[model samples]
Target: MISTPPPDWNSYVQSGIHQPNLPTIQEINKAEFAPNVIRLGTGELSPHLFPRERMKQIFHRLANLIDSLGYEEPKGLLFLREQLSKYLKTIGIEASSSTILIVSGALQALQLISISLLQRGSTIFLEKPSYLYSLHVFQSAGMRLFGLPLDENGVQTKMITKQKKRQNASLLYTIPSFHNPTGILMSEERRRELIDVCEQERLI
Candidate 1:
């Protein structure tokens, strides 16, 4: 009897509105959940680092104080938004509760923004070798990703000008504070420059 070759499973993943996560990203997701493995790249904290008692206290208060378990308003729970507004004030940011929109997490927030705000074929300028590369949310939504080089200071803002025009990029995404994977903190001066360039280019 003749031996048949193994099937190429990857050939089934056709490109379309939804794209599969990169092979490395899929591997990393599985590796993170493996027993005896410590996830260094993920945002999750170790069990010991979690504030268990404080969280329990908060949950206890919510169980007693929360009056309704019904679905929240479209934006989210008004009470939570109000609290978030107040917290923003303490950080020198003034935002009204009515303007606040809370989501489950950062991934959901990005997915919402990708579909709601961006048009199909829009380009997003982001730092090269970014954590965003690990996520297909934007790409799956019919947007393109353009990588901007990074230096010691942070993502090279100067490149945004020509590249923005060339790619017709609609917006930029960045993690300036303790940037994931790279761990490069953007300098204040570079931040200012980035703002200026974006403002000048009218690229939000």
Candidate 2:
């Protein structure tokens, strides 16, 4: 016969406050019975694809700058900012270095945008089956979210057109090119229509 554990010890062990869910990476590494774990769940690029030689040179250069190290400007490194600005211009986004607020990645960029723009109870529009991470960010910001369905072209612009007739939407979040999951691109006509709707609604 086996002895049962104490009630208080059981309660303590079951308490979720102290024992939360592990991060995806940690959980993946710790799993005892995973078979051929091709982890496409995380967005991390494969290590084999990285530019190892160039990264080594970049790290060496950054280490050399330690003597002049100070709190970087809130935006980020000026050289990187300028380089990003030039890159964006090449893609037709047309932005300046000063306008950029460099964050760690797209997740941080979405969080910053949500925090800066959303107010509690404000409504925002999103494409159906959108980025789960961005949805979480907006939810944490206390914004009301509504999903607009998508099709072969892109987000259902008809929904936006309809929404404009009634309540004001704070923002419209979309992945216009190579959309996540669906991998569909927004047509030029739809892009123009979206811009026009945003302009008409004065939402931007």
Best by TM-score: 1
In the order shown, the candidates' Cα RMSDs to the true structure are: 4.5, 6.4
Q: Which prediction has the highest lDDT against the true structure?
A: 1
Where does candidate 1 stray beyond 4 Å? 1-17, 89-94, 133-135
Residue-level error in angstroms, candidate 2, position 187: 3.0
Ten residues in a row with the worst lDDT in model 1? Answer: 9-18
Q: Per-residue alpha-carbon lDDT of model 1 for 143-186, expressed as tens digits?
A: 88899999999999889987877899998999898888889999
Error of 1 at 124 (Å): 0.7
Model 2 per-residue lDDT tens digits across residues 1-204: 999965776566455322323487357555623655654444557678999999999998889666557778999998889999999988899899999887988878877777787776788888988875677677766677888999899998888979855667888889898787577899999999888888887775
Candidate 2 clashing pairs?
none
At residue 84, what lDDT does model 1 achieve? Answer: 98
Q: What is the lDDT of candidate 2?
A: 0.78
Candidate 2: residue 52 lDDT (0-100): 97
Q: Residue 201's C-alpha lDDT in candidate 1?
A: 94
lDDT of 1 at 104: 85
